[model samples]
Target: MIDPAILEPLADDAWPARERKRLGGWRLNASSGYSMRINACWPLAAPDRDVEAAIDAVEAWYAARGLPPRFKLTDGVLAPADLAGQLAARGYREGKDTLVMVGATDGEGDPLVRLSFSADETFETVFTASAGDPEDGRERIEALGRMPPPACFARLDVDGAPAAIGVAALGGGFAGVFGMRTVPAHRRKGLARRVLLTLLSEARRQGVERAWLQVEADNAPAIALYAAEGFQPAYCYRYWSR
Candidate 1:
């Protein structure tokens, strides 16, 4: 079995959205439909019977909400041995394997970057401005805002222009990095790296030694950048949906 010390903190870091319901040992998170991480049931533990019951309850629950049934499976938890088999029997297919990476929090940000925890209108404005599509952007902003305490928003400005944006959540002895984005003209300028270091530095200052983040397995640029920063992939997780 994977150690609870590692499992619980990773879950808290990645799936920090509000809980719509707790069925069996799974967490049904549906605060937003834009991202499966927030919309699926996390099957980390439970008996086979409870898992089956949860499978039924979750399908109905999401059906009532006019959404599809989904599950997030990770390698580290007390999941049933046949969890994947059961989902496959229900015709649920896997999607988007993501790597969970961890590393030491070192190096302060570039002189141009700034970290802010106020989460005011200006932060939302700048973040959504560069993010694609207003509707999805609003969903992301709301989801990020709804995350539990010990969080902040980071921005990088060049010549008084907002160049990049990132969000960091501190919990469970780790600084969780998310929403790292650099504007079109700012890509290749290392704004993403600056934002990451800025957040990691702040996290370290706050007495955290470790930092973590998630990246799509196929995102080579992001994976390369993080690898260069000394982050090693700890595990993988994927979503399954019918």
Candidate 2:
């Protein structure tokens, strides 16, 4: 069983923020508010100061940067135990709930899937077209560009057009899948499954032992797809924001 404690940091490194700071064990990440994970503070453990003071400092930090303060709290792993209560008392509302799923890396890769060290034009096209918010797509594309070496950007083309895209961020013997998208016209064709298999196959080749991906809790179709591929839920996290 992969520990959520260990996987959380790997996830952070996989999807890095533009600017990062530390309030003791808490991680303060800011990235233009495109994604909650990149814009929120992750309290993996207790802070150096009291919880209330630490919350004040976090708000101040984000305020200095002209962004709202947010927190990513994982169930069963909340540091200081009462952190959630404190956030609620402070008027922080619970936001998007996400599930972290884990699976083995061993798999047969698809030769038709195009792999690149960076997000190519096709990948960006598919991602941006599929995203509900253009700004979110742009920010994610930028994040993809920031992925360190040994990362893989997987794309599958159908009828000479980009249909599906996914990303694998490799580090610390783990591979994290992000930016999984299928063009609306291409949905239900199992393109996502093929993309996932390709990613896991490459991860295995690169010596990654485990694979992880995050999906919104309300996305039943995606959850079913991942579950069919042997991915099991390891933990759930939600953002706390005003």
TM-score computed on alpha carbons, candidate 1: 0.91
State how far residue 131 of model 1 sits from its true place (Å).
4.6
| Residue pairs in candidate 1 whose N, alpha carbon or C atoms collide under 3 angstroms | none
lDDT accuracy of residue 10 in candidate 1: 62
Q: What are the Cα lDDT values of the candidates? A: 0.77, 0.89
Q: Residue 203 in model 1: shift from native, Å?
A: 0.5
- Candidate 1 per-residue lDDT, tens place, 113-210, comes to 77788566666777687656887677777777777777867888788877788878888877888888887887998889988998888888899888
The digit string of per-residue lDDT tens for model 2 on 73-117 reads 997776779998999999999987899999898668999999888
- lDDT score for residue 50 of model 2: 88
RMSD from true fold, candidate 1: 2.3
